[model samples]
Target chain A: MSEFEPKIVAYCCDFCAFAAADLAGAMRLQYPPNVRIIRLPCTGKVDAIHLMKAFEQGADGVFVAGCLEGQCHYLEGNLRARKRVAYAKRLLAEVQIEPERIDMFNLSSAMGGRFAEIVKEMTQRIKEMGPANTDRRQQPVES
Target chain B: MIVADRKPLEEILDSIKDYKKIMLMGCGGCVTICFSGGVKAVELLASQIKIARKKQGKPIEIIECTPERQCEFEFIDAFKKDLESAEAVLSIACGVGVQTMSERHEDTITIPGQNTKFMGYPVEHALWEERCAGCGNCVLEWTGGICPIARCAKKLLNGPCGGSSNGVCEVDKDTDCVWQLIYDRLKKLNKLENLMVVRQPKDWRTSTDAGQRRVKFEEAML
Candidate 1:
């Protein structure tokens, strides 16, 4: 079997990225099978705690995908999501984790090909960075 | 409301680095409403600390609890049973709550997890701005509900100093001129003369620096 595939958690807005992922499958656009998608009503509902928990739970990489700016079904949800991602980035940096491990993207439901590209790109980036340091599973054995 | 913000995760982790058992106490009153020392914030901090400790191969036990209002003894008393198990207490409350916890639990070390900012109100979701000086005075009726002493950059009482331009203060172009706001509000209420009345100099001793501020109830006391 191939080496352990990096586990990526994708927080997708129910209106956009989630639909795009579904479309990608329908179109048979094959991407790495490392991504685990979590559907959120709006990107804004994805708080810093969720990102941190994803890391703590051993996610090698995480990304939040929301609707394009000013197109959120819940007005300003994407904007708020952007701010939360930025805040979480700062927090991850302070903990010695490369903030780039967590990212945010904006796309429409029709962007199936784009969603596939994102998954491939994030999977490669995480492979280069190695496993997440925040993973509790990798803790050193105590005497 | 007393505004505050959570301490950085690293700093919070460092505080309890030596303690094996820690109680992360949250306040459900002023700091809660501000989103700083609330139950959600306490849980977040606790989870982060646990993860950080586990990553370092250290074993730590964290207990999370929230007092109804840390400033009052009645609320803080609820944590007496939990505090018995922890060596240190992390208070996610305003300065008053931290002090109250410290006073009540002198044997156990207490750490503050929030930096008290001000007495303020929410301007928007997750955004708060200070509004009161707590100067032991109520001048809102005279100033048409705006506190020039706090909101005004210059603290001008009689009128907007000539430094005001286009309804904004000269001290900071972004800040609204308190005198201008007072003028507009008084104009709307048809109390223009209220602005012209000479105001007495405020008594500074009655404010926070004077001594402990107290509210006594005569018949209300049981």
Candidate 2:
């Protein structure tokens, strides 16, 4: 059997988490190559529905990296993100998915090492859990 | 608005476990306002169910649709084609909407996805309390705009039952005694006299106890 390579998705906020990822690369901070980073204007823009879609599209693990709780660039965006992430976790748990398969993190824009660390952490966690069941028998959603 | 809550995922999954494909229907009326059934809810639930089925290795297909008001036959009629195509329908509308679809489209099986909770509004961000019992009588005129039938723990009409402690109902510590609220409201409006009226036992016949109720408009009838 081939070794499993988990597919992890990180939703990073533009003002902080995304910048932190950029800095991680600039500073040559090595991280797992399995993560797919998608940047949004603010973590507040992330909704439970978006997280569901990420899993539906075959994500083995997902995390939202945002600004430190009290320091959202848009004031309370990270707080809203926190609530949505929590809600999404509950939804996932209800459906027999590991709630830990999803997570949220807070970091400063300058935390390049931390950004790399989160990616590696997520990759390691998902590897232990193996891949999420992507063998869906669902028909394509009619446009 | 009529507030509702979605049924747990496991029960919903079990009910439609036989179907290979289904239409996930949503209501754009009260359930939408309550954040239980709406376009967004439909999308979220569809993804959840799909993911669950995939994990079980018996995946199902879903088509999502939300009509303006599922209780109205006309709105449900518009989706007849899709309804006929799916093996079954999972409706997230309140009970009324689910019945309307089933009654009008007898050929399709429509399964309810929500429990109709109450006729109420959001007190705060996601908190809703039953406000009106639909008793077919308006007591708000004298009670200072509060209905004891719905808000009261014991549905008391006279005054605060001794069970209340610190203005909160002993039946539920999280809930404020509605009678206390009625008293405060009437006092602020200088209408505390309204509480003093000796009220007779309510006639329960006017409520749903009379059976399935209907309101007809003669002039509007074809």
Candidate 3:
């Protein structure tokens, strides 16, 4: 059997992490191609519902990537995003999904190498965890 | 506003486990403001239910609806058409909203998704503290806007029960002795004499002790 390639979703803020991803591409930094990046104007815009929706849509893992602490373009957007990410983690755990499936990372636009490192790190973690077993059921029994 | 907390996901899942489909109703009033039963909350819960149920091979359909005010008859009437399609209803509103939905939808099985906590306001984002006991008497005039009935340990109408220490209630260390707060606030306002005027024994008839109470709006009558 072929090894499982986990599908990871990254909600990256345009100000930092999204820009960092762009920088990684520009600098030719190699990271796993398993992650699909969704860019938002700010990390604060990434809500708990959005993270859960990503999982519902077949993401093996999800992460909210924002700017470093106290450095949000919207003053406290990154901080707020971090709090929401924690809340989403708790919510995921309640549904029996591994809380490690979701996480939050802080980075700066200048850290292209660091962004690549994080992508590799998260990809490796999720690959080790394997694809979500919740996906085993494809047919929803209709009454 | 009436603050509430969502019941445990397991408890809620168990309640409608037998049903194949249900209407996930949300309230746009207090529960919405508290982040317990708003549109976003309904969406999150629906996703969770789907994910959880799908894993167990028992996926259920959820028809989501958020009325402007679930307790209001006119607002709830808007969802009558949607209710026909749902086998049951999971109302994520306060107890009043659940009762209202049940009373209005006589044929449908309506269940609560939240536990109505108390008449209170949010202290901060996602944190709520009780502010009123609904004693049906206004004592804020003398108590400096604090309700001793709700905040005090012994519901003392007069002064501190003396069980308080350093302004903390003896019943619970985390609670502030409301009488002490009332004293300081009244003293600041130069109204310490308000405490000296002994209050008459409270009439319990206005409270829950008298059973369900109703207020008739003569102006709104047909």
Candidate 4:
């Protein structure tokens, strides 16, 4: 049987994760291509709606990558983003969705290798869990 | 202003478990000022509901709308058009707003998304303490601005009970003794002599005990 390729969405801070991804490319550090990145100005700006929407839009896993603690470009943007991520996890668990599918990572702008590692780890985890069975993407309507 | 807090997300989601199309109605009056039933709260509830319903394999449709004020008929009238397609409404206003919505739209079931606490003002950000009971009596002349009915642990009209110790109430060490507060405030305003004059017991009939208070203004009336 062919392995399932989990669709992962990564909401990345433009100043850190996005920059690190670009630097990874320059450094020729290879990572799984299954992860699609969405650049956000600050992690704080990413609302709970965005994470839910990504899942609704067929993302098997969603991850938010922000700057290291106390290094947020917009003061406490990363801290706020951390709080939102924690809240989203609890909310996801209430709906029977495995909170593990959603993850938050903290890394500096220079840690290209850590960013790549997170993508691989998240992709592997989602592959084991299989596809999401959320209300927006149910398998089939039972007759 | 009235104070309230948002109902738990689980309770709200459970209330509309069978409904497919839901409208989150926010009030921009007291609830808005208290950060419980404002636009931000409506948006938060909407997001939580959508995420929750999605996990349950139910494709629920949620629409967010905020009325200028949910306590009045005219203010709630603005939501009639938006209610055309919604199966139910989750009102994030105070008790008055919830009743108003139910009265205006008898056919649509209105669920309260907040717990109406009391008529009080914000003491700090997101923190509100009861200040008045609306007893239809103003006793500030004797007790200063501190309301014994609302602030006193025992609601003592005469003076502080024996529970007061060092200006703090024994019922709650964090709370300042209402009588002590009254004394300090009265002393500051040079009204300490008024405290010595014993006032008669309050007339409960004129207060909420009268049952359903009403007010009419001759100048405002046609």
State TM-scores per candidate: 0.83, 0.94, 0.94, 0.86
Alpha carbon lDDT of each predicted model: 0.87, 0.90, 0.90, 0.85
The digit string of per-residue lDDT tens for model 4 on B105-178 reads 99999999899998998788768899988888877656877899888877788888899999999998889999
lDDT of model 4 at position A46: 88
Consecutive 10-residue window with the lowest summed lDDT within model 2 chain B: B76-85
Give every candidate's TM-score on chain A.
Answer: 0.92, 0.92, 0.93, 0.91
Candidate 3's residue-wise lDDT over A1-143, tens digit each? 87877888999999899999999999999899888899999999988999998888778899999999999999999999998999989988988999998999999999999899998999999989986766643542222
Q: How well does candidate 1 score on lDDT at residue B142?
A: 88
Ordered list by DockQ, greatest first = 3, 2, 1, 4
Interface RMSD of 4: 2.7
Compose the digit string of candidate 2's lDDT tens values, residues A1-143. Answer: 87777878899999998999999999999999888889999999999999999898888899999999889879999999889999999999988789999999999999999999999999999999987886532453332
Clashing pairs in 3: none
Cα RMSD for candidates in order: 4.0, 3.1, 3.2, 3.7
Q: Which stretches of candidate 4 lie over 4 Å from their true place?
A: A1-5, A55-60, A96-103, A124-132, A136-143
Q: Candidate 4 falls in which docking quality class? A: acceptable
Residue pairs with backbone atoms closer than 3 Å in model 1 (clashes): none
Q: iRMSD per model?
A: 2.1, 1.2, 0.9, 2.7
TM-score of 1: 0.83
Q: DockQ of each model against the real complex? A: 0.38, 0.73, 0.74, 0.36
* Model no. 2, DockQ: 0.73
